[model samples]
Target: MNNLINIFFLFLTLTTSGFSQKPTGVWDAFAFGAKGDGKTMDTKTIQTAIDQCHAAGGGKVYLHNGTFLSGTIYLKSNVTLYLEAGATLLGSANVADYPITPSKYPTYGGDLVTDKMFIYAEEAHNISIAGRGTIDGRGDDFNGPYLSPSFSGRPRILHFRNCENVQVRDVTLRNSGSWVQFYQSCRNMVIDGITVDSRENKDIEKSRHADAKGRNTDGMDLVDCQVVRVSNCFITSGDDGICLKSLSPNESCRDITITNCIVSTNASGIKIGTETSGAFEDITVQNCTVFDTRVDAISIMTVDGARIERINISNISVRNVKGTAIFLRLGARNRTYRKNAKAATGILKDILIENVQGTRIGGYGCSITGIPGFLVENITLKQIRLRFDGSNKPLLSDDDTRKPVPIAPPAVNHTVPEKIDAYPRGEMFGRLPAYGFYIRHGKNISLDNIALDYADDENRSAIVADDVDTLEIIGLKAKPSPNVSEVVQLKNVRNSPNLPKSN
Candidate 1:
């Protein structure tokens, strides 16, 4: 038995073959009493196929040429769920069809987020879901407020926790009741060529923000995972298109890479942490395109006590952006990982973003801000061009993400409240004082070869720095507003060519 098991594992490890070739150990779901009619509940039938495959030391549990309606089918070790062309694994519309299974790996706010999923794998190894097919969560069946995470009954399409050697490739994922997929506390995962469309309403402008189909249907959420690569995908969603979260400080997400993707979203295009209880280290993002985003194109945030370090982002392009090109905030929302546990402000440091271009950006521009007493550190932005459309109406305290713009900069106290404990978002600070960059409460920051401009005339400075230590700016090309004297506004900034030799 041991020798047979070893042989099965070796076979799968060697052969990641394409869909055209029928794998040797393929177990067809149709043979296991799956009707594949899109109406009959094939939950038990599909589960049986998975079990048999796992019992046989693991092979492909195949579904082909039909829509297999299922609910809460669990994956196991060394098993691959393969879907052929023109096939779909559809989720049951009834909420009770998906039984609640708590995650095996404990993470921060797990209960608060979700515990229900359609295709779940826990404590499993060498698992994969591949082939040219679709997994439709039927998200319209579950309703919630737009862009808000539902604490009530909602089902994610895929949830795998405490799993290793996982892969989900070349599949179309659609219409999750909540997050499309959540890979939590898993390692050595590869998600490639998977397209996601999780939005109930893709048009943020015409609908006037009415997402009745589903709320918080993020494209994918990789939480507390390590050694992951995501590439060659297109994502459009109601919430964050591609997101990484550290839901527990004890479990960090390390060595993650995302490249060669196209994203369009009503929320942030790519983001890290508003849940943040764990560290994120050695992450890289490259060769991506973002368009028609209602919020930040690239956002890094740490509100809870997690450390984010050694992140590199480059070669990005954005068009028709209604928010900033880049946004980084270190706040003290500090919600505990578990109940009654203490939480503190997290760290956001050692980030490099370069070789980016943004056209038709909003007036809100980029904001890199840390709170008082704790500063964001060692940040650099180089070879970037951001051109705003000169129309900006930032989100209000009520979370009205899209408000009408005024003619010019408002004459009021500097932009927003501290909102120290509020949710960290790109528009959390409202319209910034500057139309290009507003950086404050930071240390050891540098900006090189930046060009900030607008199509129409503006009434704010291009760049504003306040309460920064050890700052440097080189090769900046910016035009000031008609009302301001200098292109760059400085207040309480130190160690730069802009200031005098002495205080």
Candidate 2:
């Protein structure tokens, strides 16, 4: 049986390797009157080349050594858009050039017509965008006045909907007005070795605010996707680095793997769902590094009535996190229910996090919280180390006495309020009572070989548990502080044999 399993894996590896080789029968864009000069409007010419290539039994459409200015161009089936070295596919500045179509998903209160994307593909199979060049969305020109109350007038760089057997590799994508790449309902997708720098554009500084240049410029948004693999990418963006969502009903985001990625962003580094209407399962994230993020390093939440289970995360290192290092929440924010249908609460269970380390975290420390009657169950944390800046001094104020002093006392026997309908965020519950971790309303939780270090002496406990059942804390180490009298505090906790008594 072992030998047969090994042979099966070997065959799978070989099949994947064979698929990476370039396709044959390349058709150059310049041969079809596509002037490579930066000044020419080559939307129609370049698209014609792609159409001819697709009509001729599907091959690579090559762009080489110049800038091809284009508007929205639809990708056909069995087509590969290859950008050679020193090549660029630039987005046109005019919004009217890209025609609009009605959105497939419900847009709540927003406009129905929102299909103005730079490079779009819908219901196409065997499609790819590969090679070592760049796709530059000249996003500064589309930052006009707001078109609707919910959405702006800017377009995304790449949008693929309902595409199967897709691959995107070894390209540089930058400066998108909205999300850089959005893969919605795509199956069997592979994204590898891509570099994304969607930071604020320096060429045209139109916004008066400092961070408003690339508003809503998320690096990658995968919504309702399945069988996806994202690896070896470097992303720096203004919004969430890599986010997964389930926006459609009756469709789930499942069987996804993200590994060996380095991310730096102003928003969450890796996140799942602020729009979870379907299930999310069988996800794994490993060997990733996140730095200089304004939000949590890893955030998992299912606030919109979805079941989240079977998540595994390991070998993560985070630094300079402006918010919590890790956050998990399960709440009741059912935004997608039909009229007159009863809202349902979600389920969260079977999560494992191991070999994680973080440094320089800000005020709202790590948290795992669930609503009143619904507990986050079967969570395990092993071989974890965290460091937080425990200074009670106000970050912006210089007054030393402004810092509140600690008062040692027994754990308060009070139940935390269940903010079921509030917006789900790491900082949604004001200032956390603990410095390292705060777990509330959980079941079957375990923490092993965990260490917490603080930079300055401060008043809160290193760990706190409230309303938890079947808790275990083994080999826990916290830095000694004169102000912090206790390392662990328990309130209304049951079956906690390993925890020390609070003073």
Candidate 3:
């Protein structure tokens, strides 16, 4: 075939001449004097224009417009810091101009503080922090509750460690004293169209040893990263708006993809692990939109010993959730340091949640707890629709408030308490006898076309399954709670064969 079309046109002309060769040293931080007027201190003239564009061999360190009050800036290797929309890199409230650098792979118990941030990089590769500029992490001039010893004396506004081809595009990231971006152990990362807000100052006025308020301003903390792609983000956070951690017991946060995000959080809008010590396989959260979340619009937990399996959540839409739209947990904290000092129990298997929709959920509504020999296996929830604002009124005793408050007589079969080193949370087993989906110690579970709705008269039971085995509920539509008359509750359930009864 004519010598195979000239060897495929010389391999497409050597891959389009290596993508048309264009990185050739722009380097213009006001030509290395870097004033930008936000009160001097442009961090050694933007690190001498990024070490003279990495010694004249790489490119683009330009920053245009105004407000550049840096503190600790260091990015190297084929750099591209190009900000120029009104350019403002401003972070520096003078906590000694941020100079620490502890963490030689030390996490909790080695007590991680890890300072030296405000745009830092280590072992870098093709790095980037693209335009539409604004990286202002002047987060309340740093003082928080984050385990306060002055909270590692505050830094972190973009710390990339052991990086690879990373790209942080269209940045707006604002007001973060800690964890506004800490992509540690990175790989091919691309955080596109970013706009994190970090809810600045958080009503600051507390001085008698200030305790809380934006105490871990997490907007993006993807630790032990791999092929990550967070798209079109608009995260607003006090903590946990988009967090995924696997703090290196051997490094694992495999192929992740968080698409079309628009999260709002006081904590946990899309979270994985409370810092699980390694292993979270292929994760995908698509077309997201959570609003006013106080916690759990989607939180998957493998308390510290890791091994969370393939997860997929699709087309989510939650609004005004003060807590629990979906909180999957498998405990046994075991905060890492194996070699047989007991730390091995952690495995939450393949999970898939599809077409979710929530409105007004609060307190212990969605849970999939596990621990009694560790169940939580293959799970799937398809086409779920939850709506709960049922006012939670079940305290009537002065002659029953117009009668019909009787659905509490089923208590003799105990075996729900295997907290397994507590702190997994969906209120940590407090008040749960189901308000809307409270499955426990699960096994191969599946719920197709589930719909739970409530707005006023609530007493309990929307769907509660304790000690489940092979549950498969299809087309469940919860309604019966004229004060609670069995809207599905089965304790000590075993080989559930298409179970779906009480309505």
Q: Candidate 1 overall Cα lDDT vs. reference? A: 0.82
Q: In model 2, which range of ten residues has the least summed lDDT?
A: 396-405
- Best-performing candidate as measured by lDDT: 1
- TM-score for candidate 2: 0.86
Poorly placed runs, candidate 2 (over 4 Å): 1-24, 103-113, 144-151, 201-214, 337-343, 393-417, 500-503
Single out the weakest 10-residue window by summed lDDT for candidate 3. Answer: 395-404
Per-residue C-alpha lDDT of model 3 across residues 179-270, encoded as one tens digit per residue: 78888778999999989997643321222113444456779989878999999989887777898887666778999899998988665689
lDDT of 3: 0.76
Better of 1 and 3 by lDDT: 1
Q: Please identify model 1 stretches exceeding 4 Å from their true place.
A: 1-23, 107-114, 145-151, 211-214, 391-416, 498-503
TM-score per candidate: 0.90, 0.86, 0.37
Worst 10 residues of 1 by lDDT: 391-400
Which wins on TM-score, candidate 1 or candidate 2?
Answer: 1
Rank all candidate structures by their TM-score, best first, as comma-separated numbers: 1, 2, 3
